[model samples]
Target: MEPLYQYAWLIPVFPLAGAMLVGLGLISFNRATNRLRQLLAVFIVSWLGASMVFSFAILWSQFHGHEPYQRTLEWAAAGNFHLMMGYTIDHLTALMLVVVTTVAFLVMIYTDGYMAHDPGYVRFYAYLSLFSSSMLGLVVSANLLQVYIFWELVGMCSYLLIGFWYDRKAAADACQKAFVTNRVGDFGLLLGMLGLYWATGTFDFDVMGANLETFVESGYLGAGMAAVFAVLVFLGPVAKSAQFPLHVWLPDAMEGPTPISALIHAATMVAAGVFLIARMYPVFEGIPVAMTVIAWTGAFTAFLGATIAITQNDIKKGLAYSTMSQLGYMVMAMGIGAYGAGLFHLMTHAYFKAMLFLCSGSVIHGMEAVVGHDPILAQDMRLMGGLRKFMPITSLTFLIGTLAICGIPPFAGFWSKDEILGSTFEVSPILWGIGWLTAGMTAFYMFRMYFSTFEGEFRGNEME
Candidate 1:
């Protein structure tokens, strides 16, 4: 059973290998080899899906009800700092691993069908595999440094995937904007890492947690320093999670393919910020002012995102704002010392949100085929209506997603959001009130986008 941890690293390794294979295939093969490219793409995604199932089974058995699983592999050793690549699979990371990989697999499947005629099919699958592998590595990382490495890798893949249609100026611009904005957050995260190394003499999370009290009590780590470091560290979460002021890039990110949107917005990239907060829970808890700041920032972002979403006419942009709002809720939960609850929301959000994006993709594909347009116009809800009459399957799935995101009872979203609200109430009544208000606003905007997109008369004439 202990050896199972060694196999854990293989999960990410397989996808990385798949990515390399597909990438090389794309470069070597020409347009004449379209069939080969498609076959390779399918193989890469299939391998990743298989690896995820294997990893999940092992993780479930090892950490289902037992202690945290830690596996360390010696990497580079230097004076005063011994860097070892390792992973900590506790309840949190275990759950994240499952969510990321599963959502990624589903998105890839949806992509296969949606992008069947795309010229860059092989390139698309390669990027998808790379993104999944990076996200998996980040989730299971035991140290901040390792997490940072994979974090940047995920960002790079996001840039590539979002700008996949590089011929389109908007897609190129959106990718650049997202890349540059996230770099700002990454700078803050790097500073925090350096601060941690300076204070604790190590970058390992477990070591930092164990020695945090000693460092603080000895005055080596004061409240002011903690607060500053916490704020710097949280900058990454703010940008990555699409929190207020840094949230502009997310709505524009809809310029990418719908499948890419599902992968980035719903499953992996956006979740990285929440994961960071949970990873550093102990260190942040020791700084009261930092926690309060986190709580207020998250609450405000939630409200702001929900309000902005109401005004967005683009379907994907509306969902993008909704994602930011939901992520803010998770951040608030973490700030209020509800780590488990935040994680719960993250889990549920992954399922329903991915479903929503994929369903949107289906509708977009149908519209493209029906309208005989060179470029699809699915993003603009103003150009869409009566979709239920045209694509019944997609309509039903989209309704389920809408219901789930609205936090209606019996759906996954309701369970997670309620838990987050319950946790917020424990900390402050005012914060709880803000969260509830945001929830209601989320419901209103989501249904507005939904009804306007699918329930009204078709704004364009039917194809002859």
Candidate 2:
């Protein structure tokens, strides 16, 4: 069992292999029959399920007091520069392994149902497998360069998945918008990575942490320079996490399939920004002004997302804005120096937000029966009402997810969200006030979406 951890590299390889198999299969059977696709789906799910199990095993080992470990195989070198390929398994990596693997595993299964009839069924699973592999690789990356590589890979996968229906003009437009927007932030990230290496003389995260304070103390890294690097590094998260001003791409991402919304936007890819900040905490913590910027940015993003959601009638779009708000809440937590709370919110948000999106998928799936799959009409809340009677199970689960996101007690979100507010109040009451108000609006708009979707009279024309 102990030596099994050494084989942990297989965690990511399983899905990558599954993706390769599916990709090759597509070359031979571009339009695979339903049975063949189902078998392929099962294979993909099984491989990912193996990854999930390995992730939990690693996490379980960590919980039992196994020390953090790193493995490296030298990949490249030049004068005063080296690029190594490997993984670092610490508490953060373990936690993210579980989150990314679990959410992705579940979403893959959901995809089986959601994409049952689509021509792209097999290809969607392949993209998902690849996406899951990218995120896992990012989570366990040993160095900043590796993280950046996986980061861009994640972005590429997002572009591919979001535009899965490339023939659809909206899907093509949305994917391009996301790609271009993320490129802007990636440019900043590239600069910051270079700056960090310049400041610390290495791109290895642990080495950077070890050397950064020494450089600062010796004046090799000045305060002004550090602040610039900090802000540039944060831009990656700002755009990836859908923080305000860089947030326009996320809501528009609803043009993709619902499972993509659930997997990429709600649970995994969007959270990458928050996860990156958490990983780079040492760098950010050394700069007070940068921290203040993070906190306030989070507060404003939260409030703004909530306000916008209230006006949204499109179901996924409303949930999209809600995701932005919740992500803002997590970012605010990070800004206030509440690292644990911020990540706790990240974990809790993953489950509930993913559920909420899937529930919306269910609603839309049901609506297709009545509206004949007119994508716009099937997704409009104005056409949805009293669906609790028609979709009792989805309604019940959706209500549970709503309560969680709204911070109602006994739900997973309550404790995490309460901790964030508590931590914020200790730092700045004004920020806490904004977060508090956002909470109220979250409740109002969520229930408003709920009532508009599940309560009152059926608003669509009578079923034929």
Candidate 3:
């Protein structure tokens, strides 16, 4: 049998196959019986799930220490430049792959029941498979150029998934907004990549990091140029992570399917920004102004996202804004030089946010499943109350998510948030204070949204 490392490419390839299968099924069986469509959906999801599990098992057995493992296949090489396709397996990439694949599996499983009767079932599964493949490829990319290619692929997948229900104008609009906003940041990142290539003559992360000190000392790139490049690269992270003014698209993104929201918040779209920062931390650290800028932007965005989440009556939208706030905390941690803390928070956030979104999906699913219902009920929490009586499992899970997000002790969020805050103190007292205030507001708003959605008296009768 071939070694697992040699066949690592098959992991992402399997999902791409599933996507092709589902896409073909959609076109060929558009008018097919529901049973046939359901079978195809199950087949696609199952294949992707199996691939993920197999990849995880193989990776676990081969796990060593922090050093990255590379498997490169050359595509092109010329005098001083080389191009290749390969994977880089390190602690960070391994952790991200696990989080993304796990969340994708859960969401895919949940979709079977949640989207059982939807007409677009085949199309939905195809998009989900594509999204999974893109994200998996992104996490494993060996070079910055390859990473950028997969980065754009993931963004494209996000747009498709978010606009899956094209009949809904809000969904279409949200997709456009997200695509445009992220494109602006991507342009900055592209420029930064060009700058790095010009200065160091390489896009391989390891090579760049190894020679970073020499490049700086040779005056090929001064601190001012480094700061400019860092800020430009960071723009991509800010937009993708939903920090500050670029955050407008996220709440509206809740108009998409709940699973898409879960995917965005947990492992795919939003995480891209923080992943960039973590990937390029050494380069950013060389520029003092760039580090400070990251810290301040994160502080402001954290506070702003938390404050906005408090007033939203839409449960998923509130959670969306809250996701932005939590992401800001992660970015702030990276800005303060707490890479481990940022990643720790990212892992915990993935679990809890995914759980929260799925729980909300369950609630929405129930509301729409009332006997003999005609029009689907809205997802607005203002119209929902006393759901605990109907959805005990969902309510409990959501409660756990709420507490986790609020940074309550003993929960996952508490550990991560504390580390970020602790690290902030070493960077700046003002930033630490701002982070604390954000934490308090996060608690207040999350609980408010929770109580209003699950604890209050029933405000509307079940449709029949």
lDDT of each: 0.84, 0.90, 0.82
| TM-score against truth, every candidate | 0.96, 0.97, 0.94
> In candidate 2, what are the lDDT values of residues 1-464, reduced to their tens digit?
56756788888899999999989879877765334999999999999999999999999999999988888998998986777899888899999999988999888889989999998898999999999999988898888899999999999999999999999999999999999999888899999989988888888765686687678778877878888888899999999999978999998899999999999875568988999999988888877877988999899999999999999999999999999998999999998899999999999999998999999999999998888878899999998999999999999999999999999999999999999999999999999999999999999999999999999999888644
| Candidate order, TM-score descending | 2, 1, 3
- By lDDT rank, best first, the candidates go 2, 1, 3
Q: Give me the runs in candidate 3 sitting further than 4 Å from their true place.
A: 32-35, 62-67, 369-377, 462-464
True-structure RMSD, every candidate: 1.9, 1.5, 2.5
Clashing pairs in 2: none
Q: Mind giving the per-residue lDDT tens digits that candidate 1 earns over 202-316?
A: 7777678567668888886786786787788888888899887788789878888889999998778999989988998877887788788788888998999899999987777
The residue ranges of model 1 lying beyond 4 angstroms of the native Cα positions read 31-33, 370-376, 462-464
Model 1 pairs in collision = none
> Which 10 consecutive positions of candidate 3 have the poorest summed lDDT?
369-378
Q: For candidate 1, what is the TM-score? A: 0.96
lDDT of 2 at 252: 80
lDDT of 3 by residue, 384-461 (tens): 788898788888999999999988988999999999999889878999999999999999998887787788786657
Q: What TM-score does model 2 achieve against the real structure? A: 0.97
